[model samples]
Target chain A: MSARLRRLWGMIRKESLQILRDPSSISIAFIMPVILLLLFGYGVSLDAKNIPLGIVIEQPDTATQSLAGAFDRSEFFHPQRFGAIQEAQQALAERRIDGILWLRNDFSSRLLSGNEAPIGVFVNGVDSNQANITKGYIQGTWLAWLQHFAVAQGRALDLPVAMEQRIWFNPALSSRLFLVPGLIAIIMTMIGSLLTAMVVAREWERGTMEALMVTPLHMGEMLAGKLIPYFALGMGGMLLSVAMALYLFDVPLLSPFWLLMLCSALFMLVSLAIGLLISIVTRNQFLAGQVALVVSFLPSFLLSGFLFDIHSMPEWVQTITYLVPARYFVAILQTLFLAGPVWPVVLVNAGAMLLMLAILTVLVVKKSYKRLD
Target chain B: MSFFHILSLARKEFLALMRDKRSRIIIIVPPIIQLFIFGFAATYDLNDVPVAVYSEDRGGASRELLARIEGSPHFSILHQISSDAEIAPLIDDRKVLLVIRLGQRFSADLQRGDPAPLQLIIDGRNSNTAMTALNYLRDVVLDFNREWQHGHGQTGPPVKLEMRAWYNENLQSRWFIVPGIVGSLMLVVTLLVTALSVAREREQGTFDQLLVTPLRPVEILIGKAIPGIVIGLLEATLIIVLMVWFFEVPLRGSIPALYLGILLFLIATVGVGLMISSIAVTQQQAILGAFLFIVPAVILSGFTTPIANMPEMVQWLTYLNPLRYFLVIVRGVTLEGDGFALLFHQFWPMAIIAAVTLILAGWLFRHRMY
Candidate 1:
């Protein structure tokens, strides 16, 4: 036991030196997180604002002008005026406009006479999420215009089925709240798996694995030694991630700091284990790096519940997500960051992370070579 | 500039790529897996949204409302909530995405022609889902109200909103997303192959051997640039084929124009890859540098999110990404059948990007030639 500890100590020291010497590794470990967080936070948004809503009105009068004005006034839409339906259809095809609001010549007369008038709202529904939001915003504009019209006429009205909607966790409907927690999970996956995967595969590629194999070192000691520095690096990256989430993006960290850290640490260990196992199996830096990305980073980004909700995915894909430990990590992170100390979710996801860690650790041990064949 | 010298170098690159069995599998396998994963996973059409309905009034009207919520494919009502205490835990657990609370006066108010207050409590951690669910619920309630008014011989409001979605009538997210996925896959595959090529040679000390050879710098540059462009074109073609034949996204645009866009886009990406390669000293550094470039390019490229939705400064920054323009071109061509004449605005930006990057890569190569 003493001998194993001493060997692990020496390996850790050597591995730390290698990590320190490689300037690129250090940059990847630290700088990449900041870049990813900023890109996701500032650049990627679900809120569809400034949607190009083309408006076509023939012979515009006061009522038609106000109707167009309603669309123009709304911050959600950038209402561009068009002269003809042909021009509007061309804009729709070019994706220059998300949807079009065509008011016929009879609209003004219909509004004055209190007759049923329907304005044509032709949307570019290729991007459905944006299209759905566009529909909602247009509806809101219509309601706003009607309320103003009713007020002008001095008509008191009572409506059936008043909808009082309340958003609980993120009241302002900021996309950051959803993306930040998911970004942390994604960053942690890269830091833990990709970095560690490269480190181990690099040792093999540089032919230092042969030397380590000749020494009186246990395989477990060497594997853990190679992974320990990266684990610390990943934790540093995690702190940087949470700090960015809290300070840079102003995402509320609702749960206890310890609980959040605990979840991050667990997920980090699983990712590192995956990297170590891939490095051992591939035995080449280039192959290992590619494999790590395919299995680790890509899956974490796509398969994890970070970007796409797992509940909405197809059944086989959902089953595939069960194998991706980042999904569980994202669940934990989202709960901790958005909803404070949701214990059952934390416990379940943590247990899943530990199970994956156990499986990956066993694979790492099995794949590590005692004698080079 | 020498034809034979460039040919030999290009052949060497082709050999280097083909020699690796792992890379061979990688080039072919990702397209299929990605196609499958994207087809199934990348959907915004909300399905089976678990909702909890709590009714203080368990009358016929209340039951009908709950039945309405259950009926939509958008929602999957878990169970009726008996008390107020059960609502919080269900939402907190996320077992129930939303809680519909019906007041005691709901049925009585409905019968007496008074407005019924319906409270929708949504867990807004995933705000997109919450908003979508709310919209679905609103539509269901509207339908129920329309039916009730028809039965009672009452009329709806004056104006009717006749909304129609063009190109994609049902607003299926697949039509919007699949084209971008093809572009994303092409970018990742082509970027990595080129980024690693020169960086690996540098790491292995073979770059010095090439530098000592009689081949001109332009020849070496051509040798490095061609494989990535060819591979990128092939990838773009493969993805387009899958999109048209398999995924069934309509090919409305001119094929020649789409291919022209692909060619220009590849030039830009390959140039970016070579630029990273010239700076990186090792394979690991090359991979990281390439990833650093790729991640932000894809994010800011208007692939997943719209560039117009971003802040003013960020929108200005997206002009630098070639994929952004390509995404527009591909989506425009596929959906709108846009010819080169119609797509002139999208065409010039990508060409400018390609020329600039190629010139930059050449300059960077010359400075770092030692």
Candidate 2:
């Protein structure tokens, strides 16, 4: 082996052993991703299905019964019959049902007489997202009932204006297509920064830093030793999550796999550098871990445009999001996964990640460059 | 058996946390910063959606549609294009989310009492915003259609639905988030501190000292467990104060019930931490173990997302997660003002988790002592 290659090999051997010895490192690197992916894929969803709904028909005539019956038949809602409006109100407060549809006695008469009949829809809007979706579902079922009623009456339903909505990219509007891409960015951040944040601090805590100081190891060599193992581990994690995204969740990978792997490797390097810098600065495992979470995982989840939109935020907050590296990665992942890496988006986000890689490299080298006597 | 023995041991754990400068800051600074950051950061409001309009008809129907869209507060009409060609690039640049395209025969058809078609081309990258913006446009079109019908001396639509959101009429997201933040942040803080407790003593060579002390094994477990609960309680109290005072989210349910739920939650968390600490040889392992629990716990808890939407098996599995129950209790009290009677189903599950986990932790403590 070449002299530098020999040194690198030795470092890798040592890190591999350390990782094997510490089962938690392996757990964080491997087990954590499986758990997170399963949680995200199977557990968290914005899709509204079988939402419990309560319905009260003041007078149970054919029109009212049919209208209420339509709600019970929908794939979107599981509706229960309520005897009175007050009973439905109590159920809503207890969170037993998500919404209520109240049909008036004159529902059929008014429609036949060509007079306006108002139906009441009460939604439990405490969870604003669920409430909003429930509202849409209720309106949709009502619209379906109207069309069905018109067809049964053998009268042409006259609506002067029609809006044709064409949703580009994801026509079905599946939340998973967008959400899974963001999940990859989040999982990468967690393993990259969080796992490595304690490495150098752990060396300090174990009294190994003093022993290492006496060796003739260059700063670059030492950083490579720490980073290479975690980089490879993080990449392994990325691959696992990406596979799950493709096969398990069945989200289409429109972008080339090689290009995504390249971006993910770059993003992982930035995250690993952040972890090293934090560990070097804090030198206390407990403190370093918390700081890493503050700087890395939380920001990746919040400021990175994962769950919330960057455009919806205020101007100052938008400025802050630029500082979070995951923002660029999330943009890349979403574009690549959904829109197939339209070059302009690819160049901009990939270039920003490259900038971060340079900055974090300098930061890591500066901290590790300090002399230890 | 001695009360004073437990007190001294508890004091030592408390002082150990306070005396460490880093621990002191970890306990104090991050929670406050997270509160401010997460409060502002976690928003679901689809505010300030930028849209582009392509109106071909220079007639009254198109003009009226434009006026109605311009009036709504949710949209900022950033661009007006006379041609269809200007749209794709603007959407590609993400400069506009929705493009309102009116057909050439739009006003003519409306005048002739024939159907007019309006095309809304949406950028569905962020599906939630697209859906909300679509709903807003629908309301405008419905209103326009109704007015036109009335003006023509035609009868109004036979049936219409009136929507009202109960409890939270406006559905302000902060009402839910503030309470959720209280549960999630407290879990992390308490779990981290307790998970590191046993591992720290072993790392510092104080575990041997602790083991040789006059206190019994059960008392030692109590000493180790109490600090996490106390710290968790302190953090929970600070967050509740913020929810009530800073955010002005009303405290509707009995305040006692909320604390009772928190105490049970802390017991379950501390039990988890201690169990991990008992087996971990290093502090890093302990923290990672805590993380293993925290990540899945928070996700499964329905803190931000609803659990009912989850797969049937996953929903059943959430019964084991103490945070799931606590969140229900917390949201109940804060949003619905539900009392203990209505909240029993939430509490029993949590109490069971606490009892089972604490017992298991105590067993592990005994096994380790030997």
Candidate 3:
């Protein structure tokens, strides 16, 4: 047992040395996730703000000017005056302006007299998501303006219903609250899969795995040695991510820190086991890297419900998502960060992870134990 | 160089790729599976966003508001919290994405001829989806308000919004994504396949044997690029068909024009891949180097996300990416029904990228070999 411990320790040291030597592996493990997190946090926003809108009034009347003023004051619309509606329409077609708001003559008197006044809003619906969102904003702003106007004039604006919104978990609706947890899952997966994939295949390529195989190193010990260095690295990545989430992004760590770490460590183990399976099966660094991306990164990103809600997916797809370990990890991380640890969900996820780890470890060991001859 | 010898060498390379079962599966299955999954997954259109409502008013107005919310396809009412305090736990648990709070003054505000303030609390973690949800909610509320005003003989704004969604009226994300996937899949496959091709040869000492052959540098470059281009085109065709048939994404543009654009884009990508392969000493380095380039390329290419949303500096950098131009061309032709005249903006950038990257790759190939 003592001799076996020594061999495992030696293997771990060698693996750590190889990983430390490769700058790209470290960068992929650490830097890439940070960059992605920052990008997703800042750059990629679905909420369309400061949408450039062109407004053309045929004749400048009190009503047209006030309507245009209302549009100008809107947070959603950045209203610009165009000489002609044609010019604005052209801009919309060219994807320069999202929409054009046109007010015709005698717009103000119609509002005072309580008559049907027609306002034309032309929207460029090329990108339907943006177009639909912009359309809704434009329509809502106009309706609000009219309702306020009616109330000011001592009119009975019988509002049929009013919606009371209570934002629950994240009262502030801060993007950081949800994204930070998802980011942790993504970063850990990248580190665990990319590092493990490269390390084992690299050993095979460098002719070191063969030497280790011929030695007295047991398969279990060999696997442990291979995973330990990455476990440390994965933990380091989790710490960095947690710091960023807490400090930079202002995402609250609602759950117990130990629980978060425990779940993260288990997630890392599953990811590493997956990478190990890929390495042992392929025995080539390039093939292993591709397989790691296919099995780990894509599944984590797509099936894990990181961005898209799992409930929204088709039933068959939801069933298939169970195959991905990241699905469990994403749920666990989100729960840990936002909802605090609910043991039932956490336990179930942890058990799923343990089962996956067992399966992957068995496959990797079996593949590794096969004779090269 | 004799044709017979060239064919023999090509056959040898093909056999090697075939023998590597892992590489074959990695090369083939990922693109298909990723396309199918990403086709369903990468969407901004929020479907059935879980919303919880807390109504203090319980008046006719609050019920009407709830009806409007329920009417919209975007939101699915998951639960109704009895009080405002219940909202926090629900949100924290992620049981609900949106909370609609009706204040106590809801019925009185409307009776007193004042603007009844309604509050919507959205979990803004996924800002894009939140934003969309907010917009959708606001639209429903506003429409209800407008109808109420119209019934009371109040003159509202004269302008009606006529929105015509070009490319995808149903707003199927697959319509926009399929073309992008064609470009991305081709980029990954072509780049990785060739990125390792020369490097694997170098690692096996077969590259020295190739150098000893009387084949010119241009000949070797052509040989490497041809297979990659063929494979990339094949994959593109397969993905395009799958996208159109399975996902129901429409192909509005000229097929010939689309093919032409893909041809140019593949040349640029394959050139970059060949260059990486030539410089790399081992297959490991080649794959890593390809990965380093590919990740940035995919991110900057506006595949899953929009380029316009990127920072000014990153948006500027996107001009240099061949995939960016290809994406524009593909999206333009497929969705926008754009002719060559409308697509002229895309053509030159793609041509320029192809010319520059291919030239650079060829130069690097000769430089490294010599």
List ranges where model 3 is wrong by over 4 Å: A34-42, A73-78, A104-113, A147-159, A164-177, A202-208, A245-258, A334-352, B1-15, B19-22, B53-68, B80-85, B101-121, B146-162, B366-370
> Candidates' DockQ values?
0.69, 0.69, 0.40
The positional error of residue B218 in candidate 3, measured at the CA in angstroms, is: 2.3
What's the lDDT for residue A161 in model 3? 50
B199-220, model 2: which lDDT tens digit per residue? Answer: 8887787887887878887788
- For candidate 1, the TM-score is 0.96
In model 1, the Cα lDDT at residue B257 comes to 92
Each candidate structure's TM-score, on Cα atoms with residue i matched to residue i, is 0.96, 0.96, 0.89
Residue-level lDDT tens digits of model 2 in A7-53: 77777788889988877778787888888998888877778799999
lDDT of 3 by residue, A33-124 (tens): 67766655554444466888999888887667776888889877888898887888777656677678877665556645655666777765
Model 1 per-residue lDDT tens digits across residues A1-373: 5877888999999988988997877887789899888877888888888888889998699888887898888889988989998999887876778899989888888877867678888888767788888988887788678767667778633355668888899998877798889888887787677787777678778888788788998888888888888889888988998999999888888889998888888888898898888788887777776777677666777788776777988899999999988899888888888999988999988999899889888888877777766
Those runs of model 1 whose alpha carbons end farther than 4 Å from true positions after fitting are A59-62
lDDT, residue B350, model 2:
79
Q: Rank order by lDDT, top first?
A: 2, 1, 3
Question: Poorest 10 consecutive residues of model 2 chain A by lDDT?
Answer: A364-373
